[model samples]
Target: MNGLIGKKIGMTSVYDSTGKSVACTVIEAGPCVVTQVKTEQTDGYTALQLAYGDTKAKNTSKPLQGHFEKANTEPKHKLVEFRDFSIVEKAIGEIIKVDDVFNEGDMVHAVGVTKGKGFQGVVKRYGFAGVGGATHGQHNRQRAPGSMGASSYPSRVFKGKRLPGRTGGDNVKVKNLKVLKVFADQNLILIKGAIPGHKGAYVILEKK
Candidate 1:
């Protein structure tokens, strides 16, 4: 899972070489700095700690300021650990460009947190059919989930029942998405189809 921490820059449509129109999401990927490299001997496992997005010096805490000092880079707004590869071979402060790991037409996997929709009802969250009749003295109960349990049988609802409460804002991983294009100068990566989460949200892209 050697990948880069990136931001979704929204989506657009592009024409492929075969003259086919393709819809894609644009991501502003790294240029991320290698902050720390962990090893089994010293840290118990091999991993690379990458830092992306910049934070103003004044806005950053003193502790983080000290951490960036060792890397000889400014404080960043986001820091993530990627363990799939031995990134420790890269020196501290070493930069990983998106181009180094991916190219156009490469299959990729992306992980992101979806937008939060807050509390939701079963009809919207679980695709429940909801109340059947609109008439016959039914109004507010139209969206209700009807009976939730057997009256005197089990005496309780199942643990994993699909009753809805909170919705969205979950970590979602989308796999086998194709990379439509790569713009190195702008750090923009065009991915086929929609990605999870809203524009400007952070996402991790892995070569598949």
Candidate 2:
């Protein structure tokens, strides 16, 4: 109940009460079904497992198919467990909508995977200014990561160096994003500024 499974529905801009334009990220939140309810007596902890997005049963595994059947719901594409959920009375198979948890102006956190940019340089990945300019016969070194280590002191690149190999595709949690608008009828929530992940990527919106 503290959070809901959602899909990033892209971004848009809206005007506030002061007529100021504000950037917002649209998220299709909830209508998620409670697939399982864990209790301290049974599971050693309290949690609610919510499932969202429909999936074909043919593509689902036998164990997951039986799990969905136990909940009396169709196969879902995404399942997230929220520990110490605010709504403990929610039974399995109960539907939780976007309006059930969030409201306009509420501060929330968005957790998602960022977009992947593979095999990048330090300039793009870590904002390094790169090597010196092309002047003085410095060729093909503009975007290179310079001076990895000393010539003989260490002789090797130290661990955790900031040289880029892969970029993005990280689990990021953007905290305290204000809920700009909530269209419960459409099950969409507009949050202020940008959240992590690409369009259609799954995200978790948690109450702050």
Candidate 3:
């Protein structure tokens, strides 16, 4: 699938043709450099290794420093490969902008890390209804995760139990978001609906 690495620029509401307020998310979508191209004959797979976001030489590692040098580009903060990626006959060091692939009314899938909610209990994390009512001497066990397993038969807590230890900070995908607008000049694309990740977080926008 063809895609681009973008940064979430937060959400805004815009009035549609019917004068209805539609919520949308703004993203700075590429101007990404094609650092490497993987071919079937050479790498046993087809992919486009694209890089975005610039960084200083002192901040980049030695291996990556050499990589950007081969691409004839500056040090970048982000690099991702699109397996079986389709695009123009782009060579190494070529830049791919948002307008090159996407347009208004296009459907896309946005993937990114969700906002971290830190440590939480079952009620907040898993939406588990705790033992309700202040009956059966239930005092402060309202938000507790009740009976995990059989005491003697199954002594240990079973794996994949929905007991909350940590919440959020997971990679999530929001699919079928309609591209409401595309700004080639500014390298920005507005999509309908909320996407995963906080502001400035990197998101992968995949064409659907």
TM-score of each: 0.91, 0.96, 0.93
lDDT, each prediction:
0.89, 0.94, 0.93
Compared to the true structure, candidate 3 yields what TM-score?
0.93
Root-mean-square deviation per candidate: 1.9, 1.2, 1.5
Clashing pairs in 3: none
Error of 1 at 76 (Å): 1.1
Tens digit per residue, CA lDDT, model 3, 1-208? 8999999999998889999999999999999999999998899988899999988999999999999999999999999888888783689999999998899999999999999999999999999999787898999888889999998878999899999888999999988999999999999999999999999999999999
Best by TM-score: 2
Which of the two, 2 or 3, has more TM-score? 2
Model 2 lDDT per residue over 2-86, tens place: 9999999999999999999999999999899999999999999999999999999999999999999999999999999999998
Residue 46 miss distance in model 2 (angstroms): 1.6
**Model 3: residues with Cα > 4 Å off, grouped in runs:** none
Ranking by TM-score: 2, 3, 1
Clashes of each: 0, 0, 0
**What number of backbone clashes does candidate 2 have, counting pairs of residues 3 or more apart or in separate chains?**
0
